[model samples]
Target: MGADYLKEMFGLEGQTAVVVGGAGVLGGALCRGLVQAGAKVIVADLMEEPCRKQVDELTQLGGQAAYVVVDVTSRESIESLLADSLKQSERIEILVNCAGVNAGNDFLDATDQDWDRIMAINLRAVFQACQVFGRHMIQAGGGKIVNIGSVTSHLPLSRVWAYSASKAAVLNLTRNVAQEFAEKGIRVNAICPGFFPAEQNRKVLTQERIDNIMHGTPMKRFGEPEELIGALLLLVSPIAGQFITGTHINVDGGFTAAWF
Candidate 1:
């Protein structure tokens, strides 16, 4: 009875979820979580090869899964992703914006191109996807959206100026959109992850930086990609997260809670 009750509250048996950046490490974990919860998963990303691979893996796990190539930097491409995903599922019940990029440099050494590129993928792309998918969810009656944020969203780290700035903006945008969609039965929230070893930040996580992270993080360990699944499920689950919106979960090993 307890198991049944938990499933009733958190199971996504018939829902459809589109996970943008589903090919990446953390994103892949989020995709797996959604699928395991019983939602049909659409793996959306920039490269068809990676997206296909992710879908294949999800299918192997006994999940209904497919892929749609999306260059989040382009609005038209985002719209196309929606059209393609709708072809497979009647309506999308959840959207997870997980696509992101990063670079580290001294303030004087940052380039305009880098800043623009990071913002395009990390911040602007999220805004576009929310608007596009939010419209669909509104018409479909209701849905959930989870924007992937970073510990930087709350406490900016040194040397990753654009990434920090863009993440901060994403959290702000999540709240604003949440308010706008609250009356529409759509809940928008964010998950701020601490340091996880992902491709986007590989270049930035030098040994010294790793030490600094461990020092500030109370847990003294980097988070695993899979560790984020619980928070993701909570934010997107209709029953468990029904009353949760316009807020964020900091899954950062208490990094955000530390004082020193």
Candidate 2:
């Protein structure tokens, strides 16, 4: 606490951060973390209430914030979000893609619609948000993007075929964007989370699912929304993760490492 190496390295004094899907659990935690770092936040989500709640809470805490209803599945929504943020802040320094959905299905039972919808919300949204916001970063020198993938991207999780594939795409897409944008100063990275309470899997989060997750995770515990804050900070904070890009930070409690 004396010097706070992390603080020194990752202070977001006047930066503006956009958290897509800021209403949900993990997204809300990220909003708070960035707000605490002194970044003005724009909470974008599918629902207005949740988005407003996030903005209000941050404002109550004396942090700057704004909210907009965004359908990550739409290019227009994504474009408007970036346009509005720029109009308001003149600059956007961070973009975090936390909006995603799980396509619940066995690999063999998965339908084309199921796969497309999952990819649209999870994988495609990330790309849309990046391109829309990335243009500004490219114009203004540079920016940082932190995309949320899943641990399943690396390890197959049954009954979520499309979800897993979409996240896998996200991981690869992060690397590709990082390589293309590195010269532009736009660093791209991803966070592959194990599990947490959120809207993405509300329908599938049963006791059986919880037990299955615990069995796979070495820690035998599901992650908390707050647990993601540190990793997110390390990635988006310009000084902290300046050199860290094109990598996926797994916050899954060693879920991918345990086999036995």
Candidate 3:
């Protein structure tokens, strides 16, 4: 009975999750977690190769997963992703917006191109995906959305002005969308992650920057990709998280809590 209760609270059995940017480090971890919970996962990304690679990794780990190539910058591409997801699983119960990009440059050196690109992928893409998937979820009754924000979403850091701004907007957008869909049974939330080393921010982690991050984070260590799985599951679970929406979880190891 206890096992059944736990499963009833968190089991994603027979559900379908579409994770945009599921080819990347953090996204891949979420996909694996969804699979472990008995959900069929669709790994969506810009590149066919990386998407396929992520799917293979998930399958090898005994998870059911598939790949769908997408260009988040394009509305049509995101629409295609939604259609393809429906084709694969007949329905999408969970959606995770995790695709993002970043670059480090002196405030005076930042260019319009850099800002535009980051905003397009980090903020604009998320907006579009939510709208497209949200309409479907609303009509189908309900769904869950987890948008990837960052520690910068709460507080700004040096050297990544555009990224910080975009992430801050993401949290705001998450709240607005969540409020709009609350009565519609669609729960929208954001996950603000701390400094984790990933391909997108690898170049931005200069030695000096790394030192500052360690000092700011109470944990004094980077978060492992898998460490975010629990929070993701909590936000995605239909019963356990039924009443949760419009808020965000900061998985930054007390980074936001530290003043020094």
Candidate 4:
């Protein structure tokens, strides 16, 4: 009975989810969680190879899955992604924006190209995706959207200036968009993850930086990609998260808490 009740509240059976950046490590984990909860997942990313691989893995796990190649930097590409995703499912019930980039440099050394690139992927793309997908969801009656944020969303981190700034903007955007869509039965929220090793930030994680992160994190350890699944599920689940919106959950192993 307990299991049944839990499933009743959290199960995603018959839903459809589109996870942008679904090929990356943390994004892949979010996709897996959505699929396991019984939603048909559409893996959207820039590379066909990784998207295909992600679909194959999700299929192996007995989940319905498909892939759509998208360059989030382009608004037209994101619209195409929506069209392609609808080909697999009648309506998308959830959207997770997980694509991001990061670079570390002294304030004086930061390049315009790097800043633009990071903002394009990490902030602008999210805004575009939300607008595109939010329209679909509003027409479909209701849906959920989860934007990927970083611990930097709440507190500034050293060196990765653009990344920190973009993430902070993402969280702000999430709140504003949430308010816009609230009356439309669409809930928008964010998940701010602590340091999990991923391709985007690997170049920035020097030993000194690692030590500093550990010192700040009360858990004294880095989070695993899988550790974020619980919060993801909560924010996306219709029954469990129906009243939750316009806010963010910090899955940062006490990093944000320690800041206060």
Clashing pairs in 4: none
Per-candidate TM-score against the hidden true structure: 0.98, 0.94, 0.98, 0.98
How much does candidate 1 score in TM-score? 0.98
Candidate 4 residue-wise lDDT, 71-151, digit = tens: 999999999999999999999999999998888888998788988999999999999999999999999999999999999
Q: Cα lDDT for residue 248, model 1?
A: 99
The residue ranges of model 1 lying beyond 4 angstroms of the native Cα positions read: none
**Per-residue lDDT over 1-260 for candidate 1, one digit per residue giving the tens place of the 0 to 100 score:** 69888898899999999999999999999999999999999999999999999999999999999999999999999999999999999999999999999899999988889899999999999999999999999999999999999989987789997899999999999999999999999999999999898886789888899989899989999999999999999988879889999999999999999944
Model 2 stretches with alpha carbons more than 4 Å out: 1-6
Estimate the overall C-alpha local distance difference test score of candidate 4: 0.94
Q: lDDT by residue for model 2 over 1-260, one digit each (tens)?
A: 55577577888988999999888888999999999888999998999888888899999888999987899888998998888888779899999999877756657876788888888989888988888889989998999999998887686677877777788889999999999899999999998888887776777787888988888888988889989999998998878778998998889899887843
Per-residue C-alpha lDDT of model 3 across residues 17-132, encoded as one tens digit per residue: 99999999999999999999889999999999999999999999898999899999999999999998888988899999999999999989888898899999999999999999
On lDDT, the stronger of 1 and 3 is 1
In model 2, residue pairs whose N, Cα or C atoms come closer than 3 Å (at least 3 residues apart or on different chains), thus clashing, are none
- Deviation from native of the Cα of residue 87 in model 2, angstroms: 2.0
